[model samples]
Target chain A: MGIFYFVAFLSVFFALMTIFTKNPVHSVLYLVITFFTFTVHYILLNAQFLAVVNFIVYMGAIMVLFLFVLMLLNLNKDTEPMKSTLVKVMGAIAGMCLLATFLGAFRVLEGQNEYVTGNTDVGLVKNLGKVLFDEFLLPFELSSILLLTAMIGAILLAKKETKQG
Target chain B: MEGAFILEKLILVVVVFTVTLVIAMYSTLAERKIAGFMQDRYGPDRAGIFGILQPLCDGGKFFFKEEIIPAGAHKTLFILGPVIAIITACISSAVIPWGQDLVINGRTVSLQVADVNIGVLYVFGVIALGVYGIMLGGWASNNKFSLMGAIRAASQSISYEIGMGLSLIALLMVTETLQLGEIVAQQSGFVNWNIWVQPLGFLIFITCAFAECNRVPFDLPECETELVGGYHTEYSSMKLGLYMFSEYINMFVSSALMATLYFGGYNFPFMYDLGLSQNWITIIGVLVFFLKIFGFIFFFMWIRWTLPRFRYDQLMNLGWKILIPLAIANIVLTGVITLIKDTYFQ
Candidate 1:
């Protein structure tokens, strides 16, 4: 649909702005806008839960953290480390490689894009919950456990540093 | 039919918007009056009877005041901050059901703006996004005090939101749906209210609501003693007014949310026993709902006046250590009890 393309374009544009912005805080703000576009995209796809979760987690919490760190860093042009030509060339090479891989992957899956077809209600909470719990329960629980482990590790590291100091 | 539906929703949205603004406006006066009452002094009674026209005068003062932008401030974001604040504060009212449906000329008009399936989450997301307004405002000012205030706000909101979400999870389990209308509908009679069921969850929720709204006990973001007006240190005139006004608006929305979630919103004790018409019931329900909202708003002011502000560390500890654990335990307890009730009692 036209609305979908417009939102998609907005997402891409904001994502580019996030990367290209000179100021770190402005970059994070652009990233927040990018995340908002993703939320809109989820709504367009009828994934109400996904849309709200993206809005809260990404735009609200994560972006705030990003901006917080940037604000504390107080990065400006005078303080920024200048990149050498070699580093710049390498970065461009890496970026182009990433682009090539993404394009190739899309080309490979060009005809196999059937995951979201013919099911307007698939993204609704009830159906999504049923599928996640009944079919993908293992992966779901495993992901949660991974997050829990990371959280515990971080807390332990923090405690150890406090005791050492 | 389509045109009528659109018109009806437009009217509802306009009504809800106006009511929210009006309540936020009067809440300023009410808060001061209540503070005066607590201090055993006459409040602002000079404007009109009991200072009824005080809010209008205050609005005029704010508009007439000279606006200032700091020389070092980021110009764009400085303006964007309060704009985002007030807009987010107002939009959260869209999903709140003010009363039961009113049937006029055989057309049933729901009292809510949108009966979206994710109504609860929508409110949660909007409220969560409210921190950006403060953060942006504080950071853009390019002042150390403002930046500190912004940082405190960011951490405070993040910490409290977890407890809030966990508390809501317990309520969601009991209601078995995220739809606000459905949740209200389930608690029709007096005894069916969720407050009696999830008392601990309600406590955690109200505490987090206070923190999320940046009220008295959790109001480190704008503590006047050390930071000098905190995040709005460099803000002036109506821009500063927007920040303050948005806080009151947030209070109104959260109070409405509390009434809707726990108090059996718009559902009185025994409506059917009175044999009133549906229209009359709807009308009375709207009045009753507003009464509940006012009660909660008063409670907000009461706590604000009564309690001292929490130390930053104490606030963080209360949020993360106390409230989060209690909320998680409440969810677990709700789950186990529900399972037991279904298997054995039922």
Candidate 2:
């Protein structure tokens, strides 16, 4: 329980830091830490496969790509556009409204929240594989197809604009 | 019992850590000596007989040299780069099965530090994380060449990782387990090695391993004629040593992985027929595993000296077009064959 609270605190803190940091590279680094905390959470849930996949796909590959782009762009304080006073005031107003909505929702659901204490071993690879293949087969296949389509779309967009007659 | 278990694991961790570091240190000397032999010259023989003490001298030099951080560099991440590199390198060894269990005073002690169920994916994750060290060091250097090298490395690693994963999937189908110890156990006699079954997968895997390690033929990230010392351009002293040292460690780890995966780790021919005791068998198995690791290391160096580095376009094409497709085909083939055998032979 203590470990869960500490990790939760770290995730929220790093997520906030990701938004607040001035440097783009540092912001991405903070986001990486946020993802790492999520990985820890998955491990705490006894989902080792999910934790490792999250580590590899998010923190490893996706974050590297993020840093790669940021490095290439070489953005600095000088290049950052100054925001108008009106925009800042508008942003703060929007944030306060969102917070109010969250608080109201939590108030409504206060006593109804329930902890899920089910079969913990369902997260193990063998059990997870069986569940995914037997019960969730359609969704699993659909997700792979979706990913393939997205990949093809990316390749098309990245292709050179060929000269036409 | 719990205290003894903890102590046993602690001691195993220390031994594995020291062995990894020593092998990495010697690999540096071995690489240079191999390079010299290939080029028809004597390599660093003055440090000791056959340059045995050369790595120690190199370590001393790195320590004595002045450390430098560029004025424009990110101070925090500039120091964090090599530290991450060395940490990720050392941690990957935790799941590797060094040998069969050794009984010490009737306490059956496993040679592996941790036999995690997802050992293979853990290795993959660690290898994927390795690029951060290069990318961070390069970007933080605040040099154009460094940034270029870092970008190249990131793309190369990302590209090769897919093929590596696919090839492993084929091997997994054959072995039917994710545990490294189980995989090694499944390959018990001479004829049951994975290489014989999945030759194409092994080829794709070894090629990707070379790319992952940034060895010769896939070493465009550190190409000297370009990039100017690559990602470590602005690094000085032991910081620079850490980067180079981590590469050798990565090499050692990769070689061990290949041996364990395809070449039958810690398993030898006709071992059961020799009538040896369990303790002797375990001892010999450990030695055999190290021998296989050394052989793979020599092969890495041999290729490094023989082959010229690949062009960036060539590297990308081989990774995406050739290796990935081949790996996928190998997976399909393995699946079909397994299905047919199950139906017909049963």
Docking class of 1: high
| lDDT per residue as tens, model 2, A1-165 | 999999999999999999999999999999999999999999999989989999999988999999988899899999888999999999999999999999999888776633235677777789889989998899999999999999999999999989857
Can you write out model 2's per-residue Cα lDDT over B70-108, one digit (the tens) per residue? 999998999999998999999998899999989889889
What's the residue-level lDDT of A117 in candidate 2? 53
| Model 1 misplaced regions, further than 4 Å | A84-90, A93-114, A160-165
Instruction: Give the Cα error of residue B275 in candidate 1, in Å.
Output: 0.5
TM-score per candidate, chains pooled: 0.97, 0.95
TM-score of 2: 0.95
Cα lDDT, model 2, residue B220:
88
Minimum summed lDDT over a 10-residue window in model 2 chain A is located at A110-119
lDDT of 1 at A162: 40
Q: In model 2, which runs have C-alpha deviations exceeding 4 angstroms?
A: A81-116
Supply candidate 2's per-residue lDDT for B73: 92
- Candidate 1 fraction of reference contacts recovered: 0.76
